[model samples]
Target: MKNNDMLKNILVWVVVATILMTVFNHFSTQGQSATSRLDYSDFIDQVHQGQVSQVIIEGQTIRGVYGSGQSFTTYNPGDPGLMGDLLDNRVKITAKPPEQQSVLMQIFISWFPMLLLIGVWIFFMRSMGGGVGGKGGPMSFGKSKARMMTEDQNKVTLDDVAGADEAKQEVGEIVDFLKDPTKYQNLGGSIPRGVLMVGPPGTGKTLLAKAIAGEAKVPFFTISGSDFVEMFVGVGASRVRDMFEQAKAHAPCIIFIDEIDAVGRSRGSGMGGGNDEREQTLNQMLVEMDGFEGNEGIIVIAATNRADVLDPALLRPGRFDRQVTVGLPDIRGREQILKVHMRKVPLAEDVRPSYIARGTPGFSGADLANLVNEAALFAARENDKLVTQKHFEKAKDKILMGVERKSMVMKESERRMTAYHEAGHAIVGYLVPEHDPVYKVSIMPRGRALGVTMYLPEEDSYSYSKRKLESQLSSLYGGRLAEEIIYGEDAVTTGASNDIERATAIARNMVTKWGLSDNLGPLLYEEEDRGGFMGSSRNANVSGEVSKKIDEEIRNLIDRNYERARQILVDNHDKLEIMTECLMKYETIDKYQVDRIMAGEEPGAPKDWIEPDDSIPPAPEVKSSLEEASEKPKEDLIEKDMSNDEVKEPGEPKLH
Candidate 1:
């Protein structure tokens, strides 16, 4: 972090120096042009007339010395003054005194002091930041100037990381090797000096390393890979040395470099702005990992999500010997993460881990924690004793859709359009076998959404098929179609502006990225839309004609899907009306209610809609050995026996 600050400071100085030099050069040039406006002139006549401030006489020629006070000979022009004007002013010249001070002497004398000052200024500027004058003379550019994070400041421990069981277990072995090198040597194994943690952002990669340090009871040095780069050539190499050396001094230590992709990126790829500085930093890092220094006790752990872009040398067998992958949690893992976070909050019986875990299919550890916090906040707002499952439902919706605005208002026409729009989505969601079940649908305002149809995916889906993508596009158009079907040409607007954008992009991507279009063929022409908010246009690659064709195809796709959803809603008009009526009355309802309307069954029909009485918190299924169940009789389930404090009734908050 200090290195980042120093680089910023250095940049500031360079900018300041450049600006000052430009301004100073501009004014100095202007002054010189004004002073030297005329060549050594016949201006002596003016000086002889006493109008000129000062004058110099040389070899019968004269020049004006422009300044305060008369700085010239008082003698007449034809007086043939004694050279130095007779150091004694009273003396008159007797046929031009031999060797009178020349014009050269006078000019040199006047500007010499200024010349000296300029030279000194130039020297000092070079010292401040190297340019042309300081190649190897005490000045250089672009140094690795970020401050190094010492051991004491790395406060993260393994205990702080709630999920990523497999990742933590892999990192644990590195710590074990560092703590006792002999144990590994005895097993005929050479301890790996570096371990690379690869995962999406907020996956606790850096936090894992901090825990290793904490567990080993050793120093932890932290710095970003960018901190090793600078405008200077060798400075990055120097910083690399410094970082590893510091780690070595605190041997049996862990050095965590966050966002290693910044420096460790592939060389010569020339993507996203390029230079040799990053290359040098990465090279130095490579050597430092496997150099003659033998960093046996100093383990280097770096984190980056784009492991694909990293240099091959950095990930070789001996360098970053271990690569740990951090993935999203499974259903049971999600439950465990939710429980861990719930422990910090006041939870009621209604707040079931299994329910939330089932709902949060794609959630990471961090996402689950945020869900719990958001749920707690919701319960607090309602003055409830403890957070209920419904509060989590709201929190989950908020987490997915965004916060609810109690102050939201709607016009009658707009409200009706939204009701049908949401109904359209609900109806189509249940009709489409591939799509997740609709949990709730509401025209109530929340975040950027005018209305939302909450769907809980049945399981984690790592990849999607063309069928799935097409289904998603159809699902997206449900709202707009519902609006258009009721209002005809004049659908009351409730800001489906963003929704339109989402649906449009999905159709476009199905044609472009997913190769789902029969016309375009099955090839991912455009990159997958992993993330980015301004729609899926960030990595678009196609000509205007191609883009036009894409747009046409997307429109055709949505048009067909819209009709598909409209037909479903029309066929299920009774169910749609009932769903809309429930929404109109209650404003919001859960999955069970939605199921009743769709299945045309009574509220308590199958009894499977009810929360099960025997359900308990399930064991988290992670691949790590440490995550396995104990052989001794497994501990009693946590959720089976609920104290009064654990369960909250409808309108009461249990005091802590």
Candidate 2:
């Protein structure tokens, strides 16, 4: 690399030297026409006496020939007296015509620009190739953009990553295989050519791949999916070939490609024609993974969030032989992740990773790291020596809801409405069986909501029962139902818009996807192979009449659940009013206070509640926009109990 840099510097100097020489030669001959220099006094006297035969002015120099055929030059000082004397003498004086350039100088000037351009082009070509006369022209475009690193240089290991235990276990076997291929080969087994990691964003997929590379003690090559393709045709294919070839040379190496959906998406479905650069790239990747090139010790690892859109050919048995899922961290996984992130943070005695993990049920590994960082930031803002449980709680809330917008002003009527809306949700969630417990309820404005109610499940739930799904749908409708009942339908604000959207989605999925409706009878009316909001899939093959019936059934499910929610609120009107009063008084309350208020008792403060020191002032409150009364659901449908094959994936609807 140093040699390449030195060569580039030399090329730059060469071009600079050429330009300087051309400039110097052009000005060198400017004064050659005059043979001698005259003193100012003598020149003035000669000019006054009219001894000069022919006087000419060229720019700042005055040149003239005397009657004896002698030419001399002197500086031209604009003296009116000299001009007047010259005009009075009228000694065949004339202004010197502009100098005509010699043919050699004219040619050099005309060609200088083209030569400079050529020099620049050569310099750029050399720089691209890493040295002069290197193999870096248009052909070099095919080189892969992967950054290669030896195992000794990689510091990442399974210990460095947290919250992705299952993914580590799956990829760890590959590391073992790489370390000693004979262990598996002795048993008449062959290692998989590739491993595909599927997960949501920020689930530590790439981190897991790095761990495998570290564990195996082999070369690691990393590249992004977008790096494989370019504007020109055939470049992507060439890059894939080059990458595989390099991987083969460093046998027992690991190649990791992140966000592989960019290039591995299904071909022939794009708006552009089938022969686009991306499709060609995908085809080349397929061939290189399992082609005749015999990649004995090469193991490819790829990570993508959108695994559904990948082509079947690329995911077949021989290509991506094994698939692993890295999902959101469960409670235990979250606790471990918290511990990993908390190593650098100074914590108070009250701070507990288990408590924070319990509160953050569905947080990803990256989210946990951010939570820790935010807690530290909150401590720094308050000039605290250590982060406490309260700081962590505040950080988690900030991550889920958003920074509290305390400065926004709210009308008295709006505050009351928000209070009632949140109270309604709390009442329904508390009363519903199999529903997650409401962790906290508050009317403070956050993000886009004027108020919010948070729920934290005791454990990670993989499946849901029909009763649980119905109860969840009812809870979702609580806020909107309260708005309609208390304010009258005409006076109801748009605060329930997000709630209505979520309720409609859950109801639709129950009917069309979960087949909970008796009318649908365990049938998937919607397309099972659907993409996310970023893209769409082909329409499901259903008759128009069947589609109409599906919509009708969906409405029926929503109406039934809506009535169920309204009745729940009606039966607990007194409890709703009490909770609303408590919310208005406190502006925030926890589950314990909520339970106490429901039991018709004035509750004492918790043992852990600490009073702020008198020397420190409290933060001021800011009003913000209307917030939803419920936390946003991660998935639209409640398919907790169903297996992957039995349940249809629902496209995410509008977030509430």
- Output the lDDT of residue 590, model 2: 88
Q: Against the true structure, candidate 2 has what lDDT?
A: 0.82
lDDT per residue as tens, model 1, 26-78:
44732342334343233433434444544444444443444444333332345
lDDT of each: 0.69, 0.82
Give the distance in Å from residue 585's predicted Cα in candidate 1 to where it truly belongs: 2.2
**What's the TM-score of every candidate structure?**
0.64, 0.74
lDDT of 2 by residue, 179-255 (tens): 88999999999898989999988889988899889878999999999998899989989989988888888988999
* Model 1 error, position 405 (Å): 1.6
Per-model C-alpha RMSD: 19.1, 12.2
Q: Against the hidden true structure, what lDDT does model 1 obtain?
A: 0.69
